[model samples]
Target: MATAVVGGRLESELVRDGSDRTKGLSRRTVLGTIAWSSLLSACTSPMTSSGETPAANALATPAAGQTLGSGSVRIALIIPASANGNAGAIATGLRNAADLALREFKGADLQILIKDDRGTPEGARAAAGEAIQEGARLILGPLFAPSVSAAAGVARPAGVPIIAFSTDTSVAERGVYLLSFLPQSDVERIVSFAGMRGRHAIAALLPANGYGTVVEAALQKYASASNSRVITIQRYQLDRVSMQVQAEAILPVLQRKEADTLLLPDAGDAAPFLAQYLASKNIRQGDIQILGSGQWDDPRILAEPALRGAWYPGPDRAAYSAFAARYQAAFGAPPVRTASLGYDAVSLAAGLAARYGQQAFTAQTIANPNGFLGVDGAFRFLPDGINQRGLAVYEVGTGTATQIDPAPRTFSRTM
Candidate 1:
C-alpha cells in the first residue's frame, strides 16, 4: 500500500497547479508513510508494570510531581502542526505517545514542548531555534527529509541530539539519529532470508531514484557477502509509459534463466501490472521467485494471481495488532504505523533517565549494543546514526500473507 514519489518533472508540475491527481498522490504518500510506520511499530510486548499497555488516561490527570526536581529535561517535538495533513495526524500520535511515556515514568523530570514546523525547511529551522530557545536538550521529528536536514543544521551547532522521523538516510549524522524504516534494512532482511534458503542468483527491477539506488547497492552488498552474484540490475523510470519498456527489458533476463529471484521494489498496485506484463511474455512467477520490500504488505497485492507466493519482509502483524488496539482505544481511531516512533523515542528517553540523568540521548547510551525494544521489535542505532530494525519474512497467499520467519526478539543476528 505504499505510494511512491511521483516521477520527476511531471510530479513537480502537478504540485504547482495543485491538481486533483497531485492531491490524490499526496494522500497515497501519507498512507504509505503510515503503512511504513507499522514496520517500525511492530516490536515486543508492553513495557508496563501492570502488564497492561499504556494508553491515554481518561481523567487527563497530571502525573505526580509535574514540576519536580531542579534538573528538568525539555524535549522538543517538532512536526507539521498547521497543515491538516499526514504530519499533523502523526504529531497527534506522537503527543499521545509522549503523554503515555510521561505517565508511565512518573518520577522522571521531563517535559515535551510541541512545535509546528509548518512543513517547510525554513519553518523547520525556525522550530529548531524555538526548541533551543526553550532549553530543549533533545529534539524529535520534523518528518519530511528537507525539514529533517534543516532542523539538524540548527540542532548540531547547539550540541543537541535529534531523533528525527524522516526515512531518508542522507539526513543521518553524528548528532542526528534516524528512527524511520529504511529500505536498506528491508533489503538486507529479505536478501539474507533468500540466501539462507539457497536462492541466491538475484535480479533487481528498481525505481530510478535515491531510494532505489540505496536498495540496489544493498542487493549488491548482500549478494557479494553471501558469495552470490547479481545476475542483472535493471533501473526503471516510474511512469506508465516507461513501465512497459522496463518490463520488456526484464523479459530477456527471465528467458535466459539468469536469476533465481526477481526483486520488484515497487508499490503493490504496480505488482499486478508488472506480473501480468511479464507473464504475457511467458515469464511467470513459476519462472522465478518474486521478492519485495516491506512496502508490499497491502492485501490487494495478494489478490493478484501473478503475485501469488511472492515473498517480502514486513513487520510482525501480531505485534502491530496489539499496539494498534491500545492506540485505537485511547485515541478513538487507529494510528498510522509511525505513531509508535514518537512513543518509542520518548519511552527510550524516560527509560534512560535513571542512567543518563536529565539528558539521556548521549551517543554512548543511544548506540547501546543491546539495542532497545520498541513498538517495532528490537532496534539500535549504528555509529553512523542509522537505526536498524528487526523484521520478519512473509509469503503472499490468497487474500493474505503468512509469516514464515518471525522477527528476532534480540539483535544477535542483526548486529
Candidate 2:
C-alpha cells in the first residue's frame, strides 16, 4: 500500500569485458561471461560498513515490489513485480538480480529504493515521485513503454535520470535510457555483415505491426552506412496464410536475384514458415541468404531446419552463457534474457558512484562513448536516450547458433 526503502552491494572495479579483460579471471573481480563474483558463494549477509545503511529488507512495497540496499547515494528501481501474467515473475526475478549485482560487487556506495508500478502508467508516475522524494539520484525501470513514459513525466522535471528496461525505441530520449536489446541493432549488424559478404541488395517480409515498422525504418536509415538497399518489401499479418501470400509476393524478387538477401524480422513460426514456403517453391538452398532479427534467438527457430543458414544478431552468446551459469549458482535458478538489464543498471550505478562520486548519474558521465561492458557484453547509452550494444552475428545451425563475429569490446564512434 506504500513505498518502501532498503539498502544493498557494490562492485569496486571498472566495468570489464569478459572477452577483453587482460588480467585473466578472479572470483572477486568477475562480472562478465562468468556473470557474478564469489560474493554470492562467499558472503551470507550484505555488508555496508557505513553503519547508516538500512537493513536489506526494511519494508515491503505496494503489490509485490521489493527494496534492496542502503547507502548515501540512493537509486530507485521501479518494476511491475505484482502485475499479472509472466511479468510478475520476470520482474521479481530481475528485482532479485539488482540485489545480487550489488552483493557481488563487494562495496556499498548505493542503496536501491524499489517501487512497484503495478504495470500501470499512473502507478509508475507515483512510484517515480516517491523515489525522487526519497532522495534517489537515479531511476531504473518500469518495464513497459507506457510505464517508462509515465515515470519519465515525473523524473524528467526533477532532474533524475532513468535507465529503463523496455525494448521500445519510442520511449527513449534525452535523460531516459533503454537498457533492453533493440531490433534495430540487429538490422544494422546483419545488414552490414551481409554487405561485406558481397550482398548489397535486400528483400524483406515484414510484419504489419510496430516491430516491423521499427525494423523497416532501421533498414532505410542504415542503407547508406551498410551499403545495402531494400529492393522489395512485403508486409503481412502474422498468420500462416498471410506469410504464404507474402512469400509468394516476394518470390518474383528472389527469382530475379535482384536482392541478394531476404530479411524476415518476425520470430516464432514466422521465419520458419516463410523460409519453408520459399523452399517449397523450389528456391535453391543458396539462392539468397535469409536475414533475421534478434527475435530469432529462440531454439525452435534455430533448429527449424528450414532456416539452417539464416543469420541474426544478438548479445554475445558466450558471455550470456557464462553469466547464466553464475546466476543459477548464486540464486539457485536461471535468469531470463532481460535479467541482465537489471543487473547492469545496478552495476552501472555502483560503478559510477564509486568513481564519479556525486556526479555519477549525470548524463555526460553515463553516456561515456567507450561504453561499459557487462554480463551481456558491451553497451553504452546514446545521447538520445536510446542505447546501442556490441552485438555478435550468429549463423543458425542445427539447434545451435554459431557466432560468426565477436561483439566489439568497445563502441566504434561516439554517436
Candidate 3:
C-alpha cells in the first residue's frame, strides 16, 4: 500500500511490486534460523578475517549469502523478463539461479529487486533510474550491449556499480563491470595455445561486425605477444552467401600456405558451411589447423565433419556441467550457458557486502588481484571493469568436444 516516487514516476511501475518483495518478520525468522545453522561456516569464512585472503577453494561453497541478517543489501536485477522474446526463458533461468543461490546460502538480508529492461536501451535507463532511487547498492543486469551502456549512463552518476551481462568490452569502464565471456579472452587463449603448438601464422575469417572487429584486434594483439603473426584477416557479412564469398577470397591464401592456423569464430551453423566451402576448394584440415572462438562451443558444431580436430577456447565444461545439474535439479529445466553469470554476480555481491559492508562494491575490493572462483572457473575484475576468466581449450572430436587443456583452478600471479 506504500507508494515510492522516483523520477516523478511511481516506483512501483519501475521496480518489482506485489508480494514478491518480501521482508520484515518473515525475513527476520529466516535469518535467525540460518544464522544458527551456518555459525561455524560464517566464522571460518575468509571474509571474517582481515589477514585471510579468499582462494579458489574458499569460493567452493556459499560463503556470505548463506545467513540472513538485518540492514539488508538491496540489489537490482535488470534483465528482459517479459513474455515477448527468448529473453523470457533466459530471465527465468537467471532468476531461478539467483533464488537457488539465496536458498542454499541463506541470503535473508539480501533483497533482490527484479526490473525488466525490455531488451532496449531506453527501458534499461528507466530501470536503472528506478534501481538507484530504490536504494540499490549494486545493479546486476541489462543483458545487451546497448542496454548496458544506457543503464551505465544512469547508475554511474548515482555511484551505483553495475555488473552487466554483455560481453562488449567497449561498454566496460570504471564501475560498470561486464560478466559475459569476452571474445578477446578466448582469442588470447586459443591463439597463445596455437603459437605454443607451432601454429604461429594465424589467419582469421571474421564477420563484419563489432564482435568480429574485436576478435581481429585481439588476434593481432595476442599474436604479437605470443611470438606469432597474423598472416591475413578477412571479413564477411555473416550470411550464407557472404561466407562462401569470403571463403573463396581466403582460398588463395590457404593455397599459398602462408598461414598455419585459420580462425573461424562464427556462431550457430556457420562454421560447418564455411568449412564445407573451404573443403570444396581442396583445402583440407590437414593442410591448416582449424581454430574457433568460444562461440563454437555449441554442440551443434560437433555434427560438422569438417570441424573434426578443430580447436576452440571456452569455459571449463566440467565446472559448468556441475552447475547445470544443480540448476536443473532446482528449476526443473536446463539453464542457458550464461545463467551462471547472474548467480555469480548475486552471490559475489552478497558475499562482499557481508564481508566489507559499505566498502564491498568499491573498485579496490571488487578488482582484487586474487580474483573470485566462479562456477565456470576463476575470474577477476580488471581496473577497467572487464572480467578475465580462466578458460580451457577444447578439441572437436567425433560427435563431441573434449577439453585438451584444463582451466587453471587458481589465478596465476602473472596472468
User: Candidates sorted by TM-score, descending order?
Assistant: 2, 1, 3
What residue pairs clash in candidate 1, if any at all?
Answer: 37-337, 37-338, 38-337, 41-375, 41-376, 42-376, 42-377, 43-375, 43-376, 43-377
Best by lDDT: 2
Compose the digit string of candidate 1's lDDT tens values, residues 249-339: 7778788998888998776467677887888888878679899888776656778888888898876665456656555566556655666
How well does each candidate superpose onto the true structure, as a TM-score? 0.82, 0.85, 0.80
- Candidate number with greatest TM-score: 2
| Reference-based lDDT, residue 211, model 3 | 68
The best-first sequence of candidates by lDDT reads 2, 3, 1
Which ranges of candidate 2 are over 4 A from the true structure? 1-65, 413-415
| Residue 217 lDDT, candidate 2, scale 0-100 | 88
* Cα lDDT, model 3, residue 1: 12
* TM-score of candidate 2 to 2 decimals: 0.85
Candidate models: Cα lDDT each: 0.68, 0.71, 0.69
